[model samples]
Target: MADEVKLHGLAGSPFVCRVKIALKVKDIKYDFVVEDLINKSADLVKYNPVYKKVPVLVHNGNPISESLVIVEYIDDVWKGVSILPHDAYEKARVRFWAKVVDDKCLPALFKAIGSHAQEQAVAEAHEQLQFLENELKVKGSKFFGGDSINLVDISATFIAYWVGAAEEALRITLVTKDKFPKLKEWSDNYINCQAVKDVLPPREVLVGFFKSRFGKA
Candidate 1:
């Protein structure tokens, strides 16, 4: 079987970036095919027949969809970077947090992003941050992975970067040290990691994109 891998995604999408970041961390080499989600390609539709989403990872013509699922597939295939813990229980814990990111966090933030009213959206955005603060009460533990960047951290890319970008785009404050200190700390640490830092789309770029998106909604 051919060892070649390819990823079809766009530049600013957090979901697409998740797969890219995972590939980079795993030190896996793959071709990047930028897709116009508004006008998707036949290949994307062909591979991801269910959702027709970008961020479809094609490993030697074998396609995988969904950002988190792609990340897990990459981790399993690369078997080098160890994005998830080796221990079964710890791995379950990490995956659990990853699901928290997908199920609890991303949807809230997405609603905040494409909301018609910026004011209420900003308020809802803060609610998501509040949940993170409550969950991370273990104190002093860094990152969602509790001291190291893990699958959850990558999965929560929307919450991490898009939250800040959405707040700025909306001209509102969401993450504050006074309320979500530990989460604030985690956000700070998360952005600085080389893996994340290098991959983050420019804030101004995101701001422009989100501003237009919010305005259009």
Candidate 2:
């Protein structure tokens, strides 16, 4: 591997987790660099100068930023397991949902868990959850990709793990079984999948982090 691959990430970041899961799914061997997000490392700043964010994929010293971009880049470069579908329409569909995950789901979930306007945030998040539940029902897929985890599923990693920890830390519930059964089932399946399970941050650690960041510990 002359072009050695390395990932700069923060362990507790769901965005970083997306890259980790993508790498695991593709079975790409890469070095992991843990970046202190609160006090970012020099390499992280240099590599992702635009964002100065975690989950920068450095391939042969070339850097790629943004989780979705990095995940797609990993898929494009590696040939282990395909995350995006082959057909043009199908790939577009996956990309559509992946954007929704970033634009809608991630933002709302973050707001719901940690925003000053808790009531409004929860309401918006609940609406988004209902939309997601309906999307799963319409697609009728076991996972977002039908048979296995894919790019969209990977994009929604926060809902699968971090959201629960956030809820626990804040003493509030959002994705309860009764309210969003289908979404709940999908989350359960997603987190338990081999690639995802192996890389998931510990729940306790996540809870502590969330509490310190947003809640009364």
Top-lDDT candidate index: 2
lDDT of 1 by residue, 83-156 (tens): 88889998898888778777766776677666643667757766766766776785447876766778878987
Report the C-alpha lDDT of model 2 over 1-217, residue by residue, as the tens digit: 4669999988888999999999999887889998887798889888888989888999997999999999999999988789998999999999999998888887898888778337888889888778778889998988988989989899999998988887887788878899888889999999999999999999999999888888764
- Model 2 CA deviation exceeding 4 Å by range: none
lDDT for 14 (candidate 1): 91
Worst 10 residues of 2 by lDDT: 110-119
Q: After superposition, how far is residue 202 of candidate 2 from its true place, in Å?
A: 0.6
| TM-score against native, each model | 0.90, 0.95
* Segments in model 1 whose C-alpha atoms lie over 4 Å from true places: 116-127
